[model samples]
Target: MTALIEIHNLSFSYTGAAPHDVFSQVSFSVAPGGVFCLLGPNGTGKSTLLKCVSNVLQGWHGAIRLDGRDISRMKPADVAMGIGYVPQNQNSAFPFLVRDIVVMGRAPHLAVFASPSTRDREIARAAMETVGILSLADRPCTTLSGGEWQLALIARALSQEPQVMILDEPTSHLDLGNQVRILRVVKSLAGTGMGIIMATHVPDHAFIVATEVAIMNRGGLSRKGAPETVITESNMRDAYGIDVKVLHVAGGVERKACFPSL
Candidate 1:
């Protein structure tokens, strides 16, 4: 199958007084129904690369294509129609209802100056239900806990019904249970043939849900392969500069985990 998203020789740098490269020569692809995860330490440009893919940042030296169409030339609305991006959540001062917030995702599908139609509302409702947040529809966004707010953002992106989803640290700052919930949602979404690319600090997350994984550092992605192959002790030490033990438990529902060897 053709890749849903492709990036070749991608490089970016912030232009300012003390300019420096965030990452260079990064290449990857996400196939339909694939979960691609980027693992790295803080400030390693994982988030920057995601922004470039989403077209939120520009002037990079590389090519990004969605279904063989160059994203640089696509209109912003077209990008939104193809890729749903969920950036790190921020609190909004205005207390919009959750349903209204999710309905905003329909903007890309509606004509200019047009309001959301009944079908759009129905789609938004389905999106909410998919993320298990339909009960929060009437609640104000400001009243949500961190986990609830994150689910709302995911619902908003889901309402777009895009082919691919880009999530920047979807599990960040959440408790263990919520993190697992989000990971399960990610896997479930991919099971439905929506490509997912996520940047995360947790190595175990990649092991849990990623069909493919890459460890990114300052220069670029250092390793890319299946999670068990790419997220080993050596790569973890090289990427994070800390010793970690990658463990496999053979009990009920076997799984892999990472622990710092402090």
Candidate 2:
């Protein structure tokens, strides 16, 4: 499979702290229909990496190519056309209707001062349906529950018709059921050939949805490969400082789970 995004020799450092890089020599590639998970403990530059990939941060050195074009050379509008980003938290500052918020995703396709077209509305509607939030379209975004609001945010991004999606701890603060729901949606999206790059604290989430995994530690990815290999007890211990048991649970379809050895 051809990679939709290719990252190489990436490094980030704050000013006056050249000796203290946040993450150095970070590298990975994400192919269409593949989920490349970045899993690590907090403050390991997981979110920072996503920001750099999504072009939200600057002052980094390396190469990030989207569809054979260097991201640095792509215009912001061009980047928006191909990538969608979901942050860990949702903004409730506005009382905008769900459909309105979702429609905003069409901004990438519109000219300056232009509004969403009828076709854009149709696309937004489909996105809402895809995320299973069509019924909530009329509701105010601020009135949604945590899970529902996150669903709306996803729908908003989907409305952009992006080829790749970047999510940062998207399941944070949700109940287990909601987290599972979000992960399922993520898996479903990648099945349609949208490359997914997600930063997560949950190894189990990687096992659930990732086709490939990278374990990030201070300033680098320590291990990366298939979930079964990269999400091992040893790698988990190395990245998280916890001794864990990676168990294969017997079911109709075999499933993998991790538990801390206490």
Candidate 3:
């Protein structure tokens, strides 16, 4: 597997915030055709690291290279062309149509002051089709449920044709069914040779879809390996402050299931 993104010694610190820096000297690489899961408690630097990889926040301490290009020196538009970033929340003012919102994702490729061409629209349409949201193309964004909104956001990112996608809690605020739906979509995307890095609170998501898992601990990524190895009892307790029984559910194949150790 080719490395799509390389993060070396990545570190960040909010100006004048307590503890100074959130995490430091964190390093990892994301390979194509794989899903890398970042799991940890809130504020442990998972979301911040995603933002750094997506180029949403700058001035970090290390280097992030996307397909061998040094991302720290790249312009925002250049980064946008290669990496699609889906933040935790979004708001729309006028209830834009789903297709229109997806088309906006082509901004990185479009010339300044130029509108989306027919080809751009075609790409957006294809992206919607890829995510199984073509039926909602004409629907108002405001009318969609939480699950639909999340899928729409993913469709927008897909429209970017990014080599790698960085998502911050894609399943957050979603119902159980929606969460499973989104995870299935993620697994399908990885199957198609795209590198995916998703920050998730649900360790089960990683256990299910991630080829590799990284658990943020004590201000950096302390555990990294196969999901089965990383999502262990001790790691879960350390990262989440909860005891979970990692169980195997016998079915079509062996699948690991986690539950609170109550």
Show how many residue pairs clash in every candidate, following the order shown.
0, 0, 0
- Compose the digit string of candidate 2's lDDT tens values, residues 101-214: 999889889999999999999999999999999999999888899899888888988998999999988898899999999999999999999999998888889988999999
Error at 82, model 3, angstroms: 0.9
Cα error, residue 218 of model 1, in Å, equals 1.7
Better of 2 and 3 by lDDT: 2
Candidate 2 wrongly placed segments (more than 4 Å): 16-20
Clashing pairs in 1: none
Q: TM-score of every model?
A: 0.96, 0.96, 0.95
Error of 1 at 51 (Å): 0.8
lDDT assessment of candidate 2: 0.90
Backbone clash tally for model 1?
A: 0
Better of 1 and 2 by lDDT: 1
* Residue range 104-213, candidate 3, lDDT tens digits: 89999988999999999999999999888999999999899888989899989988899898888999999999999899888988888889999998888898889999
Off by over 4 Å in 3: 16-20
What is the TM-score (0 to 1) of candidate 3?
0.95
Q: Per-prediction RMSD in angstroms?
A: 1.6, 1.4, 1.7
Model 1 lowest lDDT segment of ten: 14-23
Residue lDDT tens for model 1, 124-204: 999999999999999999999989988999999999999999999999999999999999899999999999999998988
Q: Model 2: how far is 181 from its true place, Å?
A: 1.3
